[model samples]
Target: MVLRDPLRGLARRRARWLAVTAVGLAGFVVFVVAVAVYRLTAADPVFDRGDISGLIVVFAVSLGFAGLGGLRLRVLARRIRDTASENGFGGWLPAPSAADDDRRIDFGAETGRLRRTTRRAAALVLVWVALFTGGLAGMSLLDEAAGELLATGDRVPGVVLSVYDPGKGTPSMRVRFGSRTAKIVRDSGHHYHVGEAVTVVVDPADPEHVRTTEEQNENQFVFGLCLVALLLGLAGAPVAAGAALGWRRRARAVGVTGWRVATVDVVPDRSIGGRKRPPPTIHVRYRDGTGIVLRAVLSTHGAKALADFTDRLAWVGGWGREMAVLFPQGPRRPGPYAVPAAAKTPRAASAFRRSRR
Candidate 1:
């Protein structure tokens, strides 16, 4: 039916978002690990060159991980639904009882819990990254300050490899200190030109440290790290909040039992609102004795979700099993065993006998 297509589309969209989030979290973790390894091992210049290839590898890994994660979630959803059916819940699954909340149904409370958990987990990972990056930046500044206090570095004659204006008004210089190159911003009254010989100071013990002005050369690196941390924190904050909000909404709906169930009698190809376009028209009849009728025109995605529920109803309806219907303005409705073929079944005959008893 038209319902399966829409449900499958929704599943695909969910998978896509899940994959993107997985990739982002994985990428950030990898970055932190790479930086730690580089600093701890004091890797050589070849390791620095390898950073470019490392980035390519990270992208490839992220894509691979995303694909695997998406497929896993889809499979999990299918498994949950199948398990619910086998448990004699029929084609429709309900939310777990409050006392027995460990049980889960794919389209109901279970899915909500999964989303909330995933969002919380992702948010926590990002918070950890932000803390780590901020700490690293702080440590870098503190170490530089200590180095200056100890006067450990000596001033040496170095050549300016290049002078580039980074559009910050003040020019920055890439100076060659012995065999190493360091980019240092020119202080007030200090001017530099390409290939010009300049006096640069270096730490004899750690040649990587070079000081020229009071404005810390390493501040730029710390600033960049802090900026990344801030961005990650910002992205994570809203996602966590939204997920929490969704959880609360779902909880309210589940607790209140406000929605009534209905079965789709027919899905019209044309819009019910007299529009020329197809407007997701569904003609459904209330399953309860009230004999209420409904014609719903919903969004594409909403239509898909409703169609899926109706498809389930059709399967059980064929067997004369009563299905639940969710109504727009009334109490939940129970379906009638309107199909005569269901009455001929041995199970139905036995059920009829039991009802009389």
Candidate 2:
């Protein structure tokens, strides 16, 4: 199975991935807000070039972590399947909680369900990204439009009729702006004639330009929210992509491939992981009696991770057990591992047992 299944299964799971995703998203929002607020209150740059990668990395890590939970489930399923057939259970693995009962699970079904869940999660994530991008684009457009209109003054030649009531002491005027017009009434007792055609100055540099000195409801908050969304998305996108790549690398190291390949460890492989790195080894084992051996340079971390992961698989257990010989240090086969007919005896017998009548 691939990442899609596991990601989809994450959504279906009662695990912590959903909480992690939510927390990551919230953190993104908070970061964006903090930056915005800082810019609003201070004279510093809202964003720095050095911080872009960091922001992206954060989002990617968040996504990777969320996806990893599902991947772990898949790994667990694979392990269970491995233990079942390789460790004596006849093609059936016992459930974790149902170990007491005679209950067993079909690996294929478990794998399929996990796959579907992962696919669903991936789909949901894509949807979120699309929505976020779309929202950012829309906000950017609006911000640009507001700036442009303010720059153009947005004023067309028009007249206004002012009305004043002396008894109740009320004043109002019809104001015109660009192609549209509106009536501005003031609470202050400023009165004028009904046929007053006054010079209305709509400031070109200000979107809030109005001829009347009436109070206007400014929407700085709307811009702030949109800006927050934009920043969060901008920062999160690259990070998510990076995390995806990292995840793929990790998956590759775990013996997941279209063409099955095993590592044949002739020498003792010094398993290396975080902290002090260990030398990597290559182990290739085949189901047939025929087995080939080769030495692998474990310099790269990915390669080492793969070796370690493959080592944990039950299928490669027996091969790893028989490391009485060491593979040569070259591209050539490590040894002339000529399997005797007796070595094929058990495999043949097992195949025959499973063969259809």
Candidate 3:
């Protein structure tokens, strides 16, 4: 079937989103400039509670619009699932000829490309693991160093002589321990008043080094960091393993050739975080000579580009888990591209079609 301006609606949608995004960003910039001017011209430079609240409200609204517009733009780029139906084309293409049935396309290049992509993804995951693990190790080393310092140091009663704030970091204070006066930076979140009586751990070898008992007891921050690192590792390990396994599978299926005639259906995109949505996926369902029904989900941009073929029977080629839908006379006359796919049951596939309607 031929289409005249099939993407007219999509083009209009994109233009509208572009305008909205521009307006939102412009509004945010204006708000920022206005706030800056207000602060500069006001008698009191500091913002009051009410002024802060008003600024927050404007910031949130402008940010929300900009975010919504950006998300809509992405959704438009990803959405092709309902293009045919929306454009008033709901019929299948003609059946393939006997020659088309016998034809097979080499998928060696596609398979290699998929393998490389998977390897890169695995490498990225490994990097993520290293970064988080390194952070955890660094924090652990710091904790150990602190523990060692407290272990060998002498505990002595001290009086805070004076406190000085550098305005950027933790406040430093002068404490008198017997005849020695040591200046020590206070632990984060700890407050010390001048002339306050406190117990201090003093390093015998270096009288200038000292820490409060409270500083040694505040291991909670370190523990929290370790916990966060552990959780991040747990989250990333499976993704890395999956990518590695996927690469291995593609490597084995490098030259494998499998073809089948499949009926296509566009799977609707679902909302994420109420406003954002992932790209739509295409579902191809077919039966082999053995009478078992199989479904493959194609999520690649190339596959989505073939949305005009929805509800039509088309040739599908597979190389292990990766598959490509053949478009003999596509708009760009592009070659078939290997798309990441997963298997599903026929019953579930039909349910998806029904739901899309």
Question: All models: lDDT?
Answer: 0.43, 0.38, 0.55
Better of 1 and 2 by lDDT: 1
lDDT of 2 by residue, 54-165 (tens): 8777767755765665566566445533543354421111112222111132333322333343344345456556755665655555444434443454445555654534
lDDT of 1 by residue, 202-262 (tens): 7677767676633245555555565566456546554554444333333332333322343
C-alpha displacement of 299 in model 3, angstroms?
A: 9.1
Stretches of candidate 1 exceeding 4 Å from the true structure: 1-152, 157-161, 166-172, 176-199, 219-226, 262-357
The residue ranges of model 3 lying beyond 4 angstroms of the native Cα positions read 1-106, 152-156, 159-197, 202-210, 217-231, 250-266, 270-279, 285-337, 347-356
Q: With candidate 3 superimposed using the best TM-score fit, by how many Å does residue 66's alpha carbon deviate from the native?
A: 46
Candidate 3, lDDT over the whole model = 0.55
lDDT of 2 at 253: 22
Point to the candidate with the largest lDDT. 3
Please, what are the lDDT tens digits per residue for candidate 3 over residues 1-357? 111435556756877986887687767867864664454233235877997899899899888888999899768744522453343321111122343353344444545655676777678678767755664565556555556668888899999899888877546788887887877756545688988998889768876556776564324456557657755764665556555644544443332333455566544444565542333455555442111122234232334554434675555543213334544444355655544443332223243344355
List clashing residue pairs in candidate 1. Answer: 260-325, 260-326, 260-327, 261-325, 261-326, 262-325, 262-326
Estimate the TM-score for candidate 3: 0.43
